[model samples]
Target: MKELQDKISKKLGFGCMRLPVRGEEMEQIDDELFCKMIDTFLAQGFNYFDTAYPYHKECSEAAIKRCLVERYDREQFLLADKMPIWLVKEPSDLNKVFETQLKRCGVTYFDAYLLHAMNKDRIRDAEEKGAFAFFQQMKQEGKIRHFGFSFHDKADVLDQILTNHPEFEFVQLQINYYDWDSEAVEAGKCYETAVKHKIPVIVMEPVKGGTLANLAEEPASFLKELHADVSLASYAVRYAASLENVIVVLSGMSDLEQMEDNISYMREFCPLSEKEKNAIAKAVEELKRFPTIACTKCRYCVDGCPKQILIPELFESYNMTAQFGESPATTRLYRKAIKDRGTAADCIRCGKCEAQCPQHLEIRKLLEQVSEMFG
Candidate 1:
C-alpha cells in the first residue's frame, strides 16, 4: 500500500537515451530542439531525468551536462546517471566510470545512481569489481541519494540480483503493453518479480521506443475507436505505470510534440478503464501482424553477424518499407546504412548468430527477406 500511495508526482522520467539525433549519427543531439524539449519538460513540473555515459552516440552524458545540469537548478529536478559496467574492463575501471559520469553530468552529486543495464554478464562483472561496495561508499560520501539498477535480463537473473542486493532502493525495467507477454523480454514477469520482492520499479521504454506510438493501421484504427483524442502512446505508458510498485515511467521524449503529449498524460493520469484495458490488449494482439524482430539494437547481435550488416536496423527499414510502400528514397537510406556491411548478400548462412539469439530467430531467412525488400 505504501508503494502504491507513494506515487511521485510527474514521475515522468525523461530518458536521454534516444534524444533527437542529427541525421544518422546519434552523437549529435540537436541542441536547439533538445533544449526546447528540456525547457518544456522542466516548466511542466516533471522532474526526473535519466542519462548514462554511453546513452547516445557514446557521448550522451556530456550532452546532459551541457543541456541539463548547467540549465536547471539542482534541487528543482532529479537526475539519474548510471554506471556502465559493460564498458568497464577492470575493477579499478569502476571508479573511473563512476567519476567520469560525475564529471560528465557536471554535478557534485546525483539524485539517483544505478548500475546500468544489468544483464547476467554485467551482474557477474559488477560482483567481481565490488560494485555494491562502491555504491555503499558513494552513499556514505553523499554522491548518490538512492542506489539501484536498470535491468534487461530473464526473471531468474532479476530475482538473483534483487535477492542478493535488497539494499537497492529501486529497480528499472523495460515495461510496456507490447512487451508484457513477450518471450524476448518478459517485462510482465520481471515486473511481478520486483513486486514479490517489494521493490519500486522505474519503467524505461514504456512505449517501446516510439514503436507503439507509430503503430500500423490495425492498432491505430482500433485505438482511434476507443478514444479519438488519446494517442496510442498514452495507452502504452499508462499501462506500464498502472502496474504495482511502479515508481516512475520514463519516456524518451525527443521532440516538443512527444513531450507535451506525454506530460499531458502524467498530469491527468488515469488508470485504464476495463474497456480501455481490453482495447489495449486487443491492439497489441493486432500489432503482431507486422513482421519486425524484437531486436532493440541492444548491440547483442552486432558481434555475431558474419555479414556485418546491422540486422536490427535492416528490420527497421523493412518495417518502414512495408508501411509506406516502395519509395526509392526509403530504400536509399537503408542501402547506405548497409552498403559497407555488404547488403544481405554476404550472409554466410552461418548459425552462430542464431545460437546466441534469445528470439531464436531464423537469421538466414531474415536476410533473404531483407535483400528482396531493399537490395
Candidate 2:
C-alpha cells in the first residue's frame, strides 16, 4: 500500500472533464490545444490523468486515448477511469461496462478504477449488485492497480461506505476551501473520515468548478492583496494539496494557459502559510455576504433534465448577476447558455435534476429565480 502511495505521491493531476471545446459544443474537443496542454502537463512531471465515463458528453475517454495514450508510452502517464455505477442494472453489467471502458480508453488496464459518484443510494445499489467484488476480481487479474470510488455525500455516509468496504484502496473527494466546512459538502468531515480509515484521497473540484477562482470583488481583492502574483485558482488547489491525506489534487484544465498557471505553483508545491490560512478564512467569510448559488457545475443535472436546461451554465450566469449585478454582458451570458437549448423558463419542475444534484440544490426554485432575473 505504501509503495503504491509513493507511486502517485505527486500532488498534481490532470482532470479530463473540462477539456477545451470548440464553441459551445461539449463533444467537439480542441485536439491541438488539448495535446499541447497534455504535453506541458507531462513535461512538468505530472502523470495522473483522471477521466470518467460521462465527462465531455461521454467523449473524454476516447479523447484521452487519442491525445495521451496513442501519442505517449503507457508508462509515461497514470490513467484513472471510473465505472459508471448509475449505468449498472445487474452484476453482469459491471463487466460489460468495464470492458467498454477498456476499449474506449484503449488501455489493457487502468492505474486506478473507481465506482463513479457513489452516494447513499448508489452505494447500496453497487454493493447489492456485487460491484465491490467485481473490483477485487479486476485487481487480482491485474486489470486495476487501485480500486476505489469518487464520493458525493456527507461525512457519515462516507464513514459508512469506508466501514463497509475497507478493501477500497483510496477515495476521490470534492475538496475546496469554500465547501470544506459546508453543511452540504462536509468536505472537512469527509477528509477526516478518510484519514481515520487510512485511505489516501484524490481531490476533485479543488477550485469548485472555477467558483473559487472567479470570486466576487471583495474576496478576490482580499486574496490578491495577500499574494500579489499568484492566480486565485492556485490558492484553492494549494489548500486541498496542503492536507496530509491527499494523494493528488486534480485540476480540470480547459486550455494551455490554465495548465501553465497550475503547473507553475504545483510543480514546487507549498502548503498554505499561517497568514495565508487566515486570509482564506477571511475570504470565505466575505464570500458568504453574496448569496450566489453554490453550484459546482458538475453537469450531473444536465444529462437527465427533461427540458434539457443547461442548469450549471444558467446558474453561473445567474451568479454573475447576483455577485456583480446585471449588465449587458451577464444578459448575453444567460442568452448564450440557453441558446438552442432549454431556457430557465422552460423548466417542467419534474425534479430529475434535483435528485441527481450532489449539493442537494433546490434547482427548480433556483431556475425560477434565473428566469425572473434574465427573462
Candidate 3:
C-alpha cells in the first residue's frame, strides 16, 4: 500500500469530470475557482488527476490545460488521460483522437493513460480497432507511463480483459459503499475480480458522482452516529481507499471547499474502523428502503434528450420525495425542476435517454412515475 502511495503524491486523485462551471452550461468552466481548487489540491501534496475525452463535452481536457497543466510543472503532478475508443470510426481515428487529446491538454505525454469507460460493447469495439496494442505501443514509446483501462462492465468481462491482457498495470473502477452489493453495478464483485488478477485498482465514483456525499437522512445519520466529526463524504471515500488493491480514490470535487474537506481527511490517511464498517453496512440497508432512482447524474441522458427534460434534476426531486417522504417544499421544488424544461409527462418515449444511460435505468418508466406523483 505504501509502495502504491509512493508512486503518486497521495491516495486522493482530483477527478476533472465535474469541475466548477460558470453557469447552467457545463462547458463554460469557472476557471478562477477551478484554479484555486487545483492549487489547493497540489499544495496539499495530492498529484493524481483523471480526465477523459467526453467529459464536459470535450472541454474538460482543455480546462485542465488552462487550470492545471499550464499552471503546474509537468513533474509536479501526474495526469491520467483516456482513449475514447467509442469515438473511433476507423482504426486510423485512434491516432487523430489521441493527438487531439494531447493538443487539448497541451501535454506531450500523460503519466497515466487509460482506455476510457470500457464496457463489453466498447471493449468489443476497442478490440476491433486494436486499441489494446495501440496503448501498449504508446507505453513502449514513453508517451504513457502506466497504461491501463477504466472499466464499467461485469466481473466476467473484467476477468476476460485481465486474462487476455496481463500487461495492464492497473484498472480504474467505480467502487462505492452503495454499489458494493448492487446487482446492476456489482462493485464488490468487480473489485474482487481486479484483486484476483493482481491488478492495482484506481477507484472512481467513490462518492457515487456526489450521491453518497449528499446522503438522504438515514444513511447520513448512521455515519453521524458513528463519528460526528468526519464529513459524510469522508466515509464513502475512505471505504474505497481502505481497500489494499485500491491505489487512488478519485473524487470529482467541483470547488475549493470540497477539496479542503477531502484533503483534511486524506492528508493523514486513516482507514475505517471495524465498527464504522458495520455501521456502513447497516446504512446501506437503510438506503435500500427508499426506491430512489439510481441516476449518477452524469447527464449523458440530458445532452440528447429530444424533450430537453432535465432527467437528473427530476430524479433528484423524486429521490427527495422517496427518501424524506413527500412534502410541500419537495413538491414545489419538483414543480420548479420541470418548469422551464419539458415535464416528465412530455417524454415521447423515444428511448434515446435510456439508450445513452450508463446505469441502464428504465428511464421512460421512471419518468412516467415522476409525472404521476408530481402531476
Off by over 4 Å in 1: 1-8, 297-308, 322-333, 339-341, 347-365
C-alpha local distance difference test of each model: 0.80, 0.92, 0.88
| TM-scores for the candidates | 0.90, 0.98, 0.95
Clashing pairs in 3: none
Tell me the lDDT of model 3 at 276.
89
Whole-model lDDT, model 2: 0.92
Candidate 3 off by > 4 Å: 1-5, 326-336
Worst lDDT run of 10 residues, candidate 3, spans: 1-10
Tens-digit lDDT string for candidate 1 (71-114): 88887778888987867787788888888889888898887889
**Cα lDDT tens digits for candidate 2, 183-302:** 989999999999999999999999999999888779988789987888999999999999999989999999888988998999999999988999899999999888899999989999
* TM-score of candidate 3 versus the correct structure, residues matched by position: 0.95
In model 1, residue pairs whose N, Cα or C atoms come closer than 3 Å (at least 3 residues apart or on different chains), thus clashing, are none
Candidate 2 TM-score versus the reference:
0.98
Predicted structure with the largest TM-score when compared to the true one: 2
